[model samples]
Target: MRRVSIFVLCTAFLALTLSTGCGGGGEEGPPDSGTPYVPPVPDAGPPDAGPKPDAGPLDLAPPVVLSHSPEANATGVPPESFIEVNFSEAMQTSRGTLQIIPGDGLPNNGLLVARPEYWDVTRRTVRFSFPLGLPLRAFLTVNLANFADVAGNVTQGFRTFAFTVSDGVAPSVSSTSPSEGASSVPLSTSEIVINFNQPMDTSVGTLVPGGGLSLGTPSWTGNQALRAPITSTLVNNGLYSVRLENFRNINVKAMDGAPYLGDGKLDFGTGPDTIAPTVREASPVEGATNQQYESTRFVVFTFSEPMDTNLGMAELVDGSTRTPLATSFSGDGFTVTCDAQFKLRPGATLRVELTGFKDRAGNALVTTPFLGSNGALDFTMAPDTVKPYVTQTNVPEGATDVYPVEVFSSAGNPGYRKVFTFRFSEPMDPSVTLVTLHDAQLPSSFRNLAGVWSPDRLTMTLTISPPSSGLPPIEADKLQYLELNRLKDATGNLLDTTIPPLGDGRLNFRTLLNQRELNHACEHAETQGPLLVTATSSVTAGTPRSDVLHGLYELTLPGSGNTFSGYTRAQLITNQTQPIFMNGAPELTVTDPASPQTGIGVTLLPVPPACPSITHEARFGTVASPLNLRFSHGQQRLRIVLEDTY
Candidate 1:
């Protein structure tokens, strides 16, 4: 109506639709495409949002053989050939079936047992190989079935292939009965068996006996063997030869279908058995002395050859008395074991007597009883009844300053322990050597006792351990005794505890000063030193009565005219030396040749103090006691304190 152009009219209509209020909406703007506005129906709340539908089963296919080696019905295959199968698709090498069977419908499982499955690099192919060579000149069938693929697909059908192996090698004798050039063949030998290296044809064969030997009909005994019985009377003692013949016949060919290389032959001689079995060796050999009866295991008697035990008897003889022994023979009758229940007495000889024994050849052994000879065995039972005596001991009776082999405590002082060893004249049974350690003054828990036997079983080592509690180092003056209550030899003989009239297995020892300290203090001093004595100024003697410190001196009493009566005395006290504290009991020898007392010697004893005095009083004179001096009546007694040199 306003005469607007068509394009202008269309553009105005689009602009109006595109502008606000184009669609029938009350509050919201027009639709994006200029169409009627319609919502998505609230999304249907996630499209029904319920359980998912079942997926059902998957589609699978079976695996099939694509190709194989030695293709079906192939011929002239090697006897050791491997049967291979290639699948059409990848296969589960582990999940498959393979079988090797004879072409003929025989159920020969040996072939299947002989072959094991092997897979190629790709795993899609399987191979079967026989470790042992396959049967010769035979048609074999290989079957593969039920192989699976990666997609769970099993082969729909099985596979079968055939192959024939050609024969090549011939069979020959590997060994023979009566052996080649055999002699001394038993006249009673029953049969002769021939063994072939390779299996031979069993259809037909023959045996030709010659050289005055009569062999019975030949018979197949095994796949690769034949045996023939020797006619009893015809098997003479002279030399004879036997042969396997006619094996070259087609029916009698080897398993490889080849003729036998040559006839097998054996030559041997028959003779009567005459050699007797002798005593080849013996255990605890003849003349074995000091043998402990308790330590005696089974005695063995080895024979030169297999013996006949039908009438065998053995006895162990002690002087005129004979004791039967339980005897047993080894498998080959070449060894005999003899056992006895009673133990042999000490310092006694046992003679073994074996009689009525024969060899496999019906020959008898020497029956005479001989001493110190292989013909008769004898062993002297070690004199265990004499009782095991201690040849040496680590700690002797009344020992002093023994270095502690183990931990000990002495007057609150810890001491090193000493290993106590008891060496016996004969081997001892440590198990029965009851060793009890206790304080000499009183029974106290001052010991940690442990013992071991030397490898030779003759020395028993008893060691002390540190006390669990109480004192540590043992005191030097600790009195202890080790009582070996049940000391015994290997034969159970008790120890000679009554020797020297001491208590049974009781050893009394005293611990003294440490040896190292004592040795260091008296390194160069003679164990026994000269005693020196002098008179004090208050005395009538020429010199004051004094004791010398580690000194040698002379003492002279007042003499009327140079005839001096001299006496010497000294005391050494120490807590470090053996027999710890004591005085030197000196002996005096006058050197004056012209004097009446010349060459006179006397040993002086220091009189003990009457009370608790510091020094002892001693008098030297020819009184009731021996003395080197006849003192003048007015001579004074000397009171001297000597220095400890050790």
Candidate 2:
């Protein structure tokens, strides 16, 4: 093979346990002092022995130690010492037959569980270690029955005799009952357990209570586990411990299923694991009204795990000015309520800690002396709170237009309606738009229509799906109104009430809620004309010619000023395109300027009221778009709605 070059990569962190493939030789034990090798006189022996008897090759295989060491039946060895084995020959390194086993209650002794670094064949030696818990001269027997020599030969000898270690003192224990910092000890507590560095006596039948601690019962969780039933009672949540100095431990056994040496008490802890509390977002909201918080309310907290109820309370602070605050807590966790008066100085925050706390087991916060640095929540408050208002709508007072169709009802009744547009001078949050219909007998709903925005998130273009049906005619007749409130501008200022439904970020106009438009332009239709206005005593009354006829200038919303009274009068005419029904006696409607019937706001003229003493109303009309011969209809006005500004 060509010379090899190895590229270096980062070294691996895990350890190696098993090894593969080994080379070695098989051999017998050292020669006995009396046996000597003798050389044969080849030719002479063959001639003297006559036919040679077809002899096979002489066996020169190395010797392997089948049995030896500790001389079996020996005594007085350290109880802590572990058993070992040796072979006369260097063996193949592996988990193969060369590996050793212990003869005891539990077998497969190389190790109950193999560790990654345990199976290496380094220098033909393998070792394992563990501590013992029993007290007595324990006898241990190791077997060579499963291993083989390097030549793959199964040695016929399987060493089985055993040896004993001297009984030794077990572990020692300091204290047993009353765990550190225990508050109160309970009499209901049962089973007083103690611990020691060494194993102790545990034959229940012996009746010798070691260390004055009672062992009233002898029951193990199983054949290999241990437990003690003491005479004292352990109240719930009481502290206690087991120690050899004042108490006794249940006798522990060895791997060989026998007690070796026993003495001291051992340690065992109990209880459940606990979780830390969590804190979530606080309220009164970042920039909203910051008035009196005396009724401020409780703070809510979320936790990642079940909190240790024993960990105690959390203190609240108006961190802004470092002012101390009184706080209340909910039964669950994390959620706390602070006195509303605890104002967060202008722009400030707070923090919560979960350290210096302990669970029932005295398990401190995972963080040593946990000063609760791992968690916290923050908030900011604002002053200066104001209200909102509406500006003017882009519709004219007493506006009138004509159309070319009898598309509206013509039973000598007045029916009219239209849309009004408004423009704002500044940017606004569409969510603040408050729209409502004023008249009765109408089903109303405000849907946030889809809109386009101007460059920044500032200006919003919103639409309203006007009412189509489910309303009485009265609301549509007299007049429809528009009201608005809570309109907010970009800089977070309220819209000026003096302004129209539209507004600019800075200020608004305080315009009164009074305005009206005349809708009397209802009559016949002519392919080409301004409009027709035949005046009867009223738009709803079937009046005779005797009703003084007049032009479409008399419009008023009762309490609103009679704005059209100063306008010039008009003749009767009509635009056949826009028409309406004679419902609500006489109702009036406005029109969208961008529509085909833009100037057709005046289409039909209504008959005057036969009884002038009665109120006059007007319904609405529909506009149509026409092609060379075919015509497309514009918006249909079936009902009218109105509202006031706040």
Best prediction by lDDT? 1
Candidate 2 lDDT over 122-163, as tens digits, reads 323333334652124666654545444444544466556566
lDDT of each: 0.57, 0.35
What is the lDDT, from 0 to 100, of the residue 44 in candidate 1?
A: 19
Candidate 1 steric clashes: 29
Question: Where is the poorest 10-residue window by lDDT in model 2?
Answer: 1-10
lDDT tens readout by residue for model 1, 230-265:
885433346777766655322233332123223356
Prediction 1 TM-score vs. true: 0.25
TM-score of each: 0.25, 0.25
Question: How large is the C-alpha RMSD of every model relative to the true structure?
Answer: 31.2, 24.0
- In model 2, which runs have C-alpha deviations exceeding 4 angstroms? 1-55, 59-164, 168-331, 337-381, 385-493, 496-646
- In model 2, what lDDT does residue 259 have? 27
